[model samples]
Target: MKITNETLATQLNHRSIRAFAKKPIAKEQLTAIYEAARHTSTSQFLQQFSILRITDEAKRKAISEIAKQDYVGGNGELLIFLADLNRNAKIRQHLGQDIARLQTADLFFQAVNDTVLAVQNALLAAESMGLGGVVLGSINNEPKKLVTVLELPQLTYPILGLQLGHPAQSPQLKPRLPLEFTVFDDKYPADFSLAEFKDYDKLVHQYYDLRDTDRRVDEFTTQIGSKKLAAHKSSRDEIMAAIQDQGLCLD
Candidate 1:
């Protein structure tokens, strides 16, 4: 394919930036990124999402601790994206509509999808402007603690944290599976094989082992298998209860 637009190039070269320089992002840049995210599509136009930029140093440090990712607080900005239905719930109360309907599993997943889409837009906007970031799944390590720290309201659930800044390192671009393995035609393929992943596995192995001084130290299969079999952290075990506490009754 022809490298037509710089925007397309930016997306094609995307990589998770873990380390960052100590520079601060300008206010205009942040506003632009937020505006980009605001325009993303939402489920039924619910716009069930919120982005909290962690500005306070102590709070950032505390969240970093909760996430157990020390690099989190060092970014130009740290934003906690939330799947929020609380605003809609309030609107429903005013409109005399049923609030219980929002508690279903469908709404729960839809809100999560909406939140993720907005976050991805923000990431793309930032990256196009030469900014870099990392998504923090580690925030799930202690979701309850995060809720307390952020003081999130009911009907709102923390989905993911994003840390953006001037990149301090340029890691190699990771490999991706071929279209045949991912993109399907009219129907699902009758058969699939683990062996099809072998070639991609070699590429990933080389990427880790040769990219940096501190290598990835494991193959793709090993990584997936280990993560799959790994026990959940104590706090994450109560996820259903926590979601309910946030007023998201996915039952």
Candidate 2:
């Protein structure tokens, strides 16, 4: 076996390729990607995840409106990962099984964990095949509307959306915060020491976001500082209500 720079090959080459060429992926490969996702290590083998392939033109158009990004639905393959407890909910209901308060936390955590693991497996499978993707959290901006439009059941909730396609542009590798900032030992480290930021800040200030070409991105602190929560509380609250309404606590 020949030793190659596998880690570098994985990390140094990752770029979110939004622009995909006109090539379409084969059905066999699509089946393989879903197969990879199915085999992902799920918590308790509960398999609490669902994937919605938004292939309908009108539906994708409406979803694109919700996401506020035209490119999301315009992609070659757009998938929405979901945390679905609906399967077990119906199973238990039919079996006359009752869930207790103690089981609530377990169900919540398990679904979240299972869905994330499945999404990761799918993403890695795509990357391994040289396909590129971007996970869009913007879908959460209108969770209830997303649920209604997708016709998701009571116990199923959208997690994140993934836009994947053949790489259309080769972009540069973005730098990461140093090891000290990211890699932690047994326990979490103290707040980022004031002195440690200078180097990282300098490194960050050098890069520009392709989302806004020509202008240099603001420094990290400034970006975070500018981050404002919406004046009106929304979908997050609605989703939580939906979660509780799904009968996980047996209330």
Candidate closest to the true structure, highest TM-score: 1
Off by over 4 Å in 2: 1-8, 99-103, 209-214, 229-237, 245-251
Clashes per model (N, Cα, C within 3 A): 0, 0
What would the TM-score be for candidate 2 when compared with the true structure?
A: 0.86
* Residue 42 error, candidate 2, Å: 1.2
Pairs that collide in candidate 2 are none
C-alpha RMSD between model 1 and the true structure: 1.8
Residues 1-251 of candidate 1 have per-residue lDDT tens digits of 66568888999999999999989999999999999999999999989899999999988999889888789888689999999989899999999998887887789889999999999999999999999999887887787888889988889998988999999999889887778888998998999878888887898888888888566655677778886668766776667787888879657
lDDT of 2 by residue, 191-245 (tens): 6656667776666677655534447675665655563643656655665655565
Highest lDDT against the true fold, candidate: 1
